[model samples]
Target: MSDLAHLPATQALKLFRTRALSPVELMTAVIERAEAVEPRVNALSETMFEQALEQARKAEHAYVHGEPRPLEGLPVATKDEQPIAGRRASDGSLAYAGHVADTTHPVVERVIAAGGIVHARTTTPEFCCAAYTHSRLWGITRNPWNLDYSPGGSSGGAGAALASGTATLATGSDIGGSIRLPAAATGTVGYKPPYGRVPAMSPYNLDHYCHDGPMARTVADCALLQNVIVGPHPADVVSIRPAVHVPERLGDVAGLRIAYSPDLGNWEIEPDVAANTRAVADALATAGAVVEQVEVPLRRADVMRAAFIHFGAIFGPMVAGVADAHRDELTPYALAFAEDSRAALARDGFLAGLELEGRIYAVIGDLLDRYDALICPTAGAAALPAGEDYVDTKLTVNGVQLDHYLEYSLTPVFNIAGRCPVLNVPSGLSSYGVPTGVQIVGRSYDDATVFRIGAAVERVLPWPTRPQL
Candidate 1:
């Protein structure tokens, strides 16, 4: 039963097809796993076990008596950031605790249509702003590997659930490393498809920095979910047409020219993270991929300044608008984020942000032009405290204190360079047991190459599917 809970979606689907494993059996085991570990991990906002079991039974009927859909009976944990018409869409804020959405997000709609059963709603930071996952409404979502540390947000709960064996597949959104950070912290596979690969809610769908993607225990499973959720939607004007397809057999990266960026030239990364990143580079080289170390001509401060300015011009105003109406009800970090965004908007302005974005992309674009994919650490720090708020403090890395806590991650630059498809795969674990990850960045709209590289990496350096929970 325990093994069944941690089974990969692809393998489980095979079992269902062979009539070897009934959908009800998998759903029940998953529900039991959730009930057992959720008290410690606290990853779910709400569970639909009753509904999931019913769906699973229906899936079994379809398999036995009719045609089963692509996903068939798989359990998917939906990100709380997306709406599901008639369900509460709190945005992880107390102000909207009673708010209910009237429409389903395109990603969720696709998941349901593909026969994926949503068993739970995952937690996120308020308005999905912070790198850590905690809100006044949902409390703290801890890592399954180390309860003292966070799973990484704003998709923290999804990562935690995957690592804890409570979920086989989960959805995530990345504006500033939300998906990759959690995947790094929890030893999971996460994909941040090029901005328009997966359809999203309006406004954000137009914001190139935003991407809704997939998170799972393996690259194959991540691809499984990504293929189902991607494609154009009538409601989202910016969604890409003729949806990109992920090939099932991503054979190998035997002759691929892969580039490596150890520190991106400027950010101060911890010694462990640097070592793990190099280890991945070494593994890629061993697999016949030409992994060459390259220099990133960029500064952490400049990249973050542009990210904040962009956020200020777009996401910041939305959060600030909410804050203006309900100052007392918001989380302290959310309030701080709003204030910081307003200040950023005033200082750098939108046009300046656009210029900086172009400069940032020029660096990545140039690198990708020379190489098939670029590799780098997902986050500089291995883990962050689950419950502590780093809103007001400067974070330290490599014994050097930084100006801002968010500087610890190397994820925002990719958001600025929004056209590249980036996938996060585990590199190694810290001495403290927290996981570290590296990103495989591909050329614009070239999603298959990144997944191919990811599949190669997974074959060489496999990540443990479940924490020792």
Candidate 2:
């Protein structure tokens, strides 16, 4: 059962097809794994074991009758931030700890409709605001690779669960580096599809920077889950038309133009991270792709400012409204974020951010025009302490003080230029055993290209599927 828990969705599906694996058996293994690891990592905020078992039984029936659906019998862990109709959606806030969602997010609905079993709801930082996953409502979500370090958030739990073999497939939402950061830290694969590529819940659905995508142990598995969740939805006005299908076997990247940036022009990347990133570039080069070291016209300050400005202009107010009603119950970080957002809004920071984003995109657009794809270190540093918060912590990369904790993460830049698709693939492990990753950034709406490059990289520099949990 423990071994069964670690099986990839692709392999599990094959087993299901041959009747070598039963959905009930798989779900039971996953639930047992979740129970065993829950105390150490605290990855899941809510468990739906019985519900999952019931679903799994139905999936087994489907398989017996040869009527299996797309994601038939697979166990998936939903990020706590997303709603699952009639289920508790704390969003990692004390205010919503007892709240029940009336309707499901279109992506989760798609997962369920495709026969994916939702066994657990993973944890997130309060309001899904922080990079490290710890909340007043759900406690802290730790890295399975190294328990002292964070798995990364706002999709931290999803990353941890996947790494710990507690879930076969997990859903993640990326705004800034939520999906990719954890994916990098936990040695997993995460995809941040282009804006509107996957439907999101209201409010965030229209926000270009916010995206819902897949997290998995392997690139092919990630693509499998992504294919199910993506596509147009009438509920989300911004959802893309005519969904693009990603191939199960994303073949070679031979003869493709790939550009690699070590620091993105300003970040102070740790030695291990830089080495691993360069190694990935070398592997890509050796794999028959033309990989070159290039500097992107980006500054750490510009990226962080743009992300905060956008968050302040929109998410800040929404969180503020919640804070007003439950002032005392809010997390310290959440309060600080609200206060900072208010200050940014007062100075017309949103418009300033837009101006800077335009300049940043101009440079990125030119780079993408010349190169088929871009690759860079996903996080400047490998990992941080599990409980570290953006407010109190001082992040130092190579002895230089960072302006903010998120400065280490290069993902927010893509959110500012939200049309591009980014995939985070594991590079290697640091001395501390925490994994490092590189982001494969593609041209605007060119989802297939990034996956191709990522798939190529994955094949050349294969990573361990599950963490040492």
Query: What RMSD does each model have against the real structure?
Result: 0.8, 1.1
Local distance difference test, candidate 1: 0.92
Candidate 2, poorest ten consecutive residues by summed lDDT: 341-350
- Candidate 2 matches the true fold with a TM-score of 0.98
1-469: candidate 2 lDDT, tens digit per residue: 7899999999999999999999999999998988888899999888889988999999999999999998999999999888978888778888987889999888889999999998988889999888899988778789999999999988999999999989999999998889999999999999999999999878889898899999999888999999999899999999999999897667799899999999888888999999999999999998999999998878998777777788888888888999999999998888888887777667766678789889989888999999999999999999988887868768888889997788988899899889999999999999899999999999999988899998888888998877776
lDDT of 1 by residue, 192-299 (tens): 999888999888998999999999999999999999998998988889899978998888889899999999978888888999999999999999999899999989
Error of 2 at 204 (Å): 1.1
Q: What 10-residue stretch in candidate 1 is worst by lDDT?
A: 386-395
The runs of at least 3 residues in candidate 1 whose Cα sits more than 4 Å from the true structure, single-residue gaps closed, are none
Query: Residue 330, candidate 1: how far off, in angstroms?
Result: 0.8
Per-prediction TM-score to the true structure, in the order listed: 0.99, 0.98
- The alpha-carbon lDDT assigned to residue 165 of candidate 1 equals 89
Clashes of each: 0, 0
